[model samples]
Target: MTFTGGNPQEEPPRRVAKKSKKRFLWLALVTLLALIAVVLSVLYDRGEFDGLRRRLLYTKAQKDENGCAQLYRYASDQSGSFASLDGSLVSVSMHQVSVLDETGKTVYEQTVKFQSPALVRGAFRAAAYDVGGTSVYVLTAKGLACQVDTSGEILAVALNKDGYLTVTSNESGCKAAVRVYDASGQPVFAYRSADRFIMTAALSDDSRTLAAVTMGQSSGVFTSYVVFYRINSESALTTTALTGSLIYDLIPMGSRFCAVMEEQLCFLDDSGEVRAAYSCGSDYLRRVDCGDGYAALLLGRYRNGTQHRLVTVDSDGQVMASLDVDGEVLSMSAAGRYIAVLFSDRMVIYDKTLAECARLDAVSEARQVLMRADGSAVLAGSTAASLYLP
Candidate 1:
């Protein structure tokens, strides 16, 4: 009765209650949102979520835990030759080499009117060389630049991080010559061989030592040799003979050399002495790749056996792991401690001990694959290129 508007006191209580309810709801909502955010962060750390929101919510593509944020569809059905240098993708097609970054954006592109097959690698930023020809081109911010082409056809080439290069060339049927060059296109050293075919070579980090694997006829029979040279002195350091095998590739690991042979994996020191060796019995070694202080060998069966195997080896020539799969390996790549092997219909990624980290299903047959240091892979299929992040 004392109120002027029938119940001024009652109106204050009702208004107070309503305001209290609104405040409670606001506090509860904030608490719930914060709790949800914390739970999601924990799950992501445990890989339970693998940051799926990054792929689903973000506008720009980013690599998720599944390692899939990039893809490319080739204009042609042909599979291409490629290599990784500086995390850039250098792919070779019919008459062109395309360089792309991790985002699938084409950074640089080059065409060859000469119509010869090409090879590309990430060395000195990026480089592309003609396979089975004499032309070698290195690309930089300036443009497509050619290395000093010497006499004879260029058979093999290797480049270091500092742009130091090693080229193997043959003159007719006589012999092969191995030469090392600095970044300025000046020859560091040249080693000549008579009656020996220099198949391939590798340069060390300091560009001090050059390793070459050559094959020659000894007593009317084929014999392979692992040779080392001191680039500064232009003098031969060591030459070791290998029997009953053919050397296919030479790779540098730290201060040692890994010689990939047909039936064996041999390690040689800087002096070219065989430090360790692993034999494959009758199995034929298909390919050997070194990364993350390890070497991986792709082995085929003996005398037309069906199943194939992959052997993970350490720098000390220790057999760390072996995985046998039932198909021909279409392509393989290794980075850091990860090894990626692609079959016709699927791909498998393994760690240093050859444990299965991930198995990616493929829609079509993959022709080749490129792996990254973070256990991600890019599989080049006939129709498209798929990036697998894990």
Candidate 2:
């Protein structure tokens, strides 16, 4: 009442206050919009907006009887060792690894040798297979592992399959013992572990990083700890522990995610943190693989009972899809756009969505199914092995 004219200073203060509130409101709105943008980006990156396509089906032709008969008759032939088998080329070994086209014509052949005597011994015990590419990995006895190229040269040699190797050409000058090699057989980077023995070792599809399990060894027992390492451009290394358990299997889900099986199924991040754990109902889990953002768990009973269950989950431990089968899944493989599920007498092909797309009656029990990156499959059993083209 006393200041009827309204003080000029008071007016200025009021104006400043109003302007400040307005500015804050605008800032808050911008922040909210930025948060929404980030969320949308994440969802898009996770493939949440992708549309589902219809599951396609294909008729099964009796596995080319002539081809099967040829492979069967040649299984024991010393001249028939596999150099490569995928797509249009099937390479067998006689004097050297021989490359052949689908029509049984020679394409390429080369002479390669094992690096170390230990490696050579391991090579003989290895189950060698080709990925339809220039690289080949040998899973050896004593758990020694190595990869070679088309030239049949040793690229990288791991003392044990659990990711320890010697890096040849890094800045560290082979001082860094835990190293990984590229497809060209060059030691690009190195890693270090806390434990001397590794229980499991899994290489990513890109081969940039390796997931491994180190174990504390006793007289006869071992306690396992899982870890991962990144191979960087500087040839330097960084490692992180993922979990502690008696790991039975480790499967990489891209470079950042991995499925680790101990007593329970656990999903781990690149840093080895457990993102999720699933209590596998069965006592024995034979194999596990992931694709299309889903994991396929193969469980078996001692009496030959088997089941195939597919679980799709996100990084947050949320289940997106679950598929179950009544029959025993004898063997399985996944690559590219398909998952090949091998049962006792039938071969079922499912898309990434876990929906059955194709079925074929097999001649005998399926022991192993090898899914190639090129969309072909090789089904090997106790009695027979046949290749399938999709």
Candidate 3:
């Protein structure tokens, strides 16, 4: 009678123990899953998966009948500059700078006063500074990377594709000073000139070479020179004498450099010797812009007329393409292998061969056109900016 049920009570206890074990295992599993989720969230917030996310989530923008998608609308200055950086829209105004993501979301905004604000874009970063002021800000797609307060007034600034910055300022003891900074805002190289004025300087794309345009006087005749230097040393690599109108732009194109002057476009090699020079030949240079390995020059027969020709020149100083522009060119931009030209009534996008890729009509509100590496263009208006997809 005492053990009559054949250990039925023992069976109940065994079943209870089995249920408890299963419950514990379920709790442990859930805890592990939660921890994994948290770690993934942190990584996402830190942008550790940005590249993968962008690739996996790539979606074509929904465009309207004008082949345009409104990116962002904000109160902005009419003369502000717009540039594309890492799939974000960077708008530089007189008193503020804003960055908007591809989804038309504001990612960063900073308020600063700038009398003559200018913006230049690299691959993933941008350099915004006052043309004649002391404040310089380096920005990325997320936010401001660094702010550089120079000891003197800022004259010109250049940002390479890798975010290397070159700032030419007016120092007290020298006619002009050129300072090069790495991506972290740390000064890596500095040179002060006492004999000639350094108009502007640019660091090569590889960050190994430096090119400076200097204006000097020889025999009471104004002379300009493209001086090349190694970033790690103080000695000049070579000096290519350029005697003519003032040099307006100096761009580093791989092993060579492209110098844009008032009257001609000169391409120089690493030895600082002119490889090829393209003269305007009766057509006056109206507007000039440099892209990846090519320069876009808008030349006109008359000083300020619609009878202009858009010319694309390669690093070898050869004309890659040319188009007769019959309309007034309001703004033009180049990136990768395409160029975007904004007219008073329309916008035209062309390939490197000057072939028409896409055109958007009735876009008179766009004040500027900024090309993306993917061939899309960002059209900036007075108070809003739109993305044009072809």
Candidate 4:
């Protein structure tokens, strides 16, 4: 016939070639899908997805003429009762703790009887506790993560970026005690001091090191000691004594710790030794806040009608920037690389170099400012809170 010229072996070779081409196409598609998966994983780890989701879900805050958008209006207008945590607003009243999203949606709410309600926020979590009381509630954006009931009164509480909690309490049989809990509310470490009373404690970001401030008197002189400990060890790793200044707070930044004192800001290494200290010269320290790798201090003269000085210091105690602010400063907040200063007549946002990035005038209702790491700010008013995006 007309097809008799074709060989049977030739037909078999053509079939094999088709099969090989199909296999190659399948392999190429699998490789492309694997690459896409890897890219998504990296983006998720860096919080890109979270940021995108927040932008999409919280689009209700429309900018007004002053670039200020009312993100949430509080149910109660109690001053010093609201905080910002992970793009959400946390309000702690005497009877309830509420967590609201950017669109003013209630994410979580609980009834609590706190004599003095206080909030400590981390990267993605916030802890609501009663100052000098026994109730402590650890929370996340989803809901209440855990509740810790200490054996004694809660003196001070610190939260790391990862939500690890360091609680200092006045426990029985000891002058003070420090307890560390993980983000999941599991107990990680505990220490009780009988010689010196622990004022406050901070857990390192890695959760492997714990640093606590202890107040004691040596030779009839008031002294403060920073005690370092390995969470796995029962003994103190190191102790560094600081004198002449009243230690106000202890904040752990990465591998080191920053001790906020009455007269100076001291940066301590992991061994509890002072790496650098920035002394507030003739100015009196009025307010201070610590961010990722820097500290902002508000210093002013004791006289009226004088401008206040705002200083920013790096983790190595190097002065990064200083700005002279005129007017009455109501509150100051630092987070990430930006600092938010709320004055009587206006609000100013400054970068790490103390350069004014944005300013909004006539903010008389704003009592406090909470700066976010994304250059946005939450202005806490007596009755409502608004978001300012620059």
Q: What do the candidate models score in CA lDDT, each in turn?
A: 0.72, 0.48, 0.84, 0.84
Q: What RMSD does each model have against the real structure?
A: 11.3, 12.7, 11.1, 5.7
TM-score of candidate 4 on Cα atoms, chains taken together: 0.84
- lDDT by residue for model 4 (141-216), tens: 6668888888899999988877888899999999999999887788889999998889889988788889998988
Provide the global lDDT of candidate 3 against the true structure: 0.84
Clash total of candidate 2 = 2
**Candidate 3 regions off by >4 Å?**
1-60
Give residue 81's lDDT in candidate 4 (0 to 100). 73
Q: Compared with the true structure, what per-residue lDDT tens digits does model 3 show for residues 1-390?
A: 564545876557767899999999999999999999998888654434433453444456666888678867878577588888877888887888888888888888888888999998777889888889998889888878988889999999998877899999999999999999999999999888888889999888889888999988778888898888888999889887888789988887877778888789998877788988888888999888777788888899888779989999988778998889889888988887778899998899887788887898968788889887667788889988888766
Q: What is the lDDT for 321 in model 3? A: 88
Rank by lDDT, highest first: 3, 4, 1, 2
What tens digits encode model 2's per-residue C-alpha lDDT throughout 242-304?
A: 344566656555544555555466667665667776765554566665554566556554435
TM-score of each: 0.77, 0.55, 0.83, 0.84
